[model samples]
Target: MEVIQVKNLSKNYGALQAVDRVSFAVPEGSVFGMLGPNGAGKTTTIECIIGLQKRSGGEVTVLGLDPAISRKELYGSIGVQLQETVYQDKAKVFELCQLFSSMYPDPLDYKLLLERFGLEAKTRTYLRNLSGGERQKVAIVLALIANPRLVVLDELTTGLDPQSRREMWAYIKELQAEGRTIFMTTHYMEEAAHLCDQVCIIDEGRIVALDTVDGVIENAGMDTMISFETQDEIGMVLEKLPGVNRVEQEHEQVRLYSQKEDVLTDLILLLREHAVEYRKINISRPGLEDAFLQLTGKEWKEKVS
Candidate 1:
């Protein structure tokens, strides 16, 4: 079943179009990733779908109801955690949890939530005294307390440590197991690749690519990367080589980008014929970041940084 659907969704700020004719569908009980660099219209599209921001054009439906018209009914079935969340600085950890729980029809157990989030020791700690990561944890706990059927998590693991991030990912997987659908926006390509059943790659408010993890890789024409150590700077005209698109130099290492699997083999044969001395030769398939860069023509560094 389709839990969320957006058709020709567009948002404009005067002359600048933030999201232009964006369209996608998120299935029920699946993790749908909305991925892009900074100013990609990802957040704008999300706001439109969630009915937090009015859409200038197009259609949006969440759980078979128009978000703009049926927002009140939809709120009960959806949990939302924005990128930036703040609470009363003087409130204690337990107090904040209890406060948010009261807003829900039947929230998760307060003690269980505290234990699940490793905040038991900090139960008495004031919100202002908590670290950035801990604050994020509290925010997430509040968002999920309702056990809503759908969850929209923007930058879900932004301030988490590696261990905490992994744990949160596990928790999200468990939520899906219990038949909850997740719509998430993230700058981390690896996170999307690992957790999302489908992803939509947005750039400048438009979907440049949308598909499964493997499908995006294939569609972006990112197949192989060849690397090896060389003694002399072998000025091989790699740009003219078949299936090779670009060549880059890092220190004394050469990395070649190509969609052809045979490019590495061909390079080895060429090196052997030319007596090019080298060591530590290797070939690797492209990762999610590689595919993302190829498709959107935007650097991940530009987003996360």
Candidate 2:
């Protein structure tokens, strides 16, 4: 069953079309990810889907009801954590949690959630006194307090430390085990690769690619990358070798991309034949970021930075 369905969804801000004819579905009991560079319409698409923003065109259904028309009805079944949330500076953690819990008929134990998130000691802490990561944790706790059937997270682990991020991942997996659908937007390719069953890549307000993790990598047709630092200028010589698709050279660094399985062996033999000394050699298979680069023609790191 699809917990969320979007068809030709478009959102505009005056003359700017933020989301352009985007379409996708979120299956029940699965994690679905929306990935794209900043200003790629990911947040706008999410807003339209959840009825937080009015879409200029297209349709969206969440839990079989139109979000724009039945937002109140859908609220009971959906929990949302936005990228940015504003809170009263003087508000206490426990007070806010209690307020949110009151909105739901049967909410989860906010006290237990505070303990689970390691915020028990800060239950009476003022919202303004908490660190960015701690505040993010509070947002997550409130999102899940409803015991919602569907959870929507925007940049879910943005402010978390490595340990907290992994802990949150485990918690999300637990939510899935309970048959809750998860729809998320994230800039982290590794996070999407690790948690999402399906991912949609959007660029410039349009859908560029959508597939399973491995499927996207395979379909991108990106070659394996080999990088090394060497004093010898062997780029021209290596480019002529069979199985070497391309070679890039910069001062003492060289990079080779190839689709051939024997490219590594070929490189070794060529280097030995010419007695070209090399160091810091490394080889890597194409991953989610590579696929993003292949389809968008933009480096993931550069995009995020």
Candidate 3:
């Protein structure tokens, strides 16, 4: 069942086009990822859905109800976590959860939510004194305490360390099992790849790619990077070999790229012929990070550089 459907969604600010005719449907009880770079208009598209921002054109429906026309009804069924959260630092963690829960007609148990989120220990901690990760957990707890039928999370794990982030992902999986539909946005490709059942890749307010994580990889068909130890100046040898598109001698490692899995097979045979003593071989497939670059025409490496 489709819980959310957007068509020809367009949003603009003065002369700048924020979202341009983007269309996609999110099925019920699925983890949907809205992915893009910082200026990719993801937030604008999401805001349009939640009726936080009015669109210049297009239509948005959540649970078959139009956002603009049914704003109040929609809020009762949807939970939202914004990219940045503002709260009184003096408010105790448990107190905040109770306050948010009271606002909803049917809310989850505050105590259970706190324990599940590993926040019971900090129940008395003031919001202002919490670490970035801890404060994020508090925000998540308030969002979910509503027990909303649909949850909209933006950069859910932005400030979290790897361990806490993983724990939170696990919680989301649990929520899915309870049949809640989720629509979230994040720049963390790996997190989206692992958690999202379907992904909408947007850029400059337009939809670029929309599909399952595996489907996107299959579409790109980029070869993975494989590294191996080889002697015999494998540089020139592997360069002329089939299935090995590029070869370089970096210290003592030979790097290879191939869309075909047999690239390593041919490399091994050549190594045997040269009687080279190999240490180890490593192979990795192209991930969501690679797909993002290919679709956006942006070098992801440069971003980190």
Off by over 4 Å in 3: 233-253, 269-277, 301-305
For each candidate, the alpha-carbon lDDT, in order, equals 0.84, 0.89, 0.85
- Candidate 1 Cα RMSD (Å): 3.6
lDDT tens digits, residue span 1-305, model 1: 89998899999999999999999999999999998887889888888898999999999999999999988888877888888777899999889888878887878787787778788898889999998777877876787788788999988777667777787788788778989999998877888988999999998888988899989888887658788888666656566678888887676798888888688777888778778888887888977888877876766662442
Better of 1 and 2 by lDDT: 2
**Across residues 149-208, which tens digit of lDDT does each residue of candidate 2 receive?**
999998877656777778778888888998999999988888899999999999999998
Steric overlap count per candidate: 0, 0, 1
**Candidate 1 minimal-lDDT segment of 10 residues:** 296-305
Q: Where is model 2 poorest over a 10-residue stretch in terms of lDDT?
A: 296-305
Best by TM-score: 3
Worst 10 residues of 3 by lDDT: 296-305
After superposition, candidate 2 runs with Cα above 4 Å error: 159-163, 227-256, 260-281, 302-305
Encode model 3's per-residue lDDT on 159-265: one tens digit a residue: 67888888778888988899999999987888898799999888888888899998887687687788877554667877777866676678788788777768778
Q: State the local distance difference test value for candidate 1.
A: 0.84
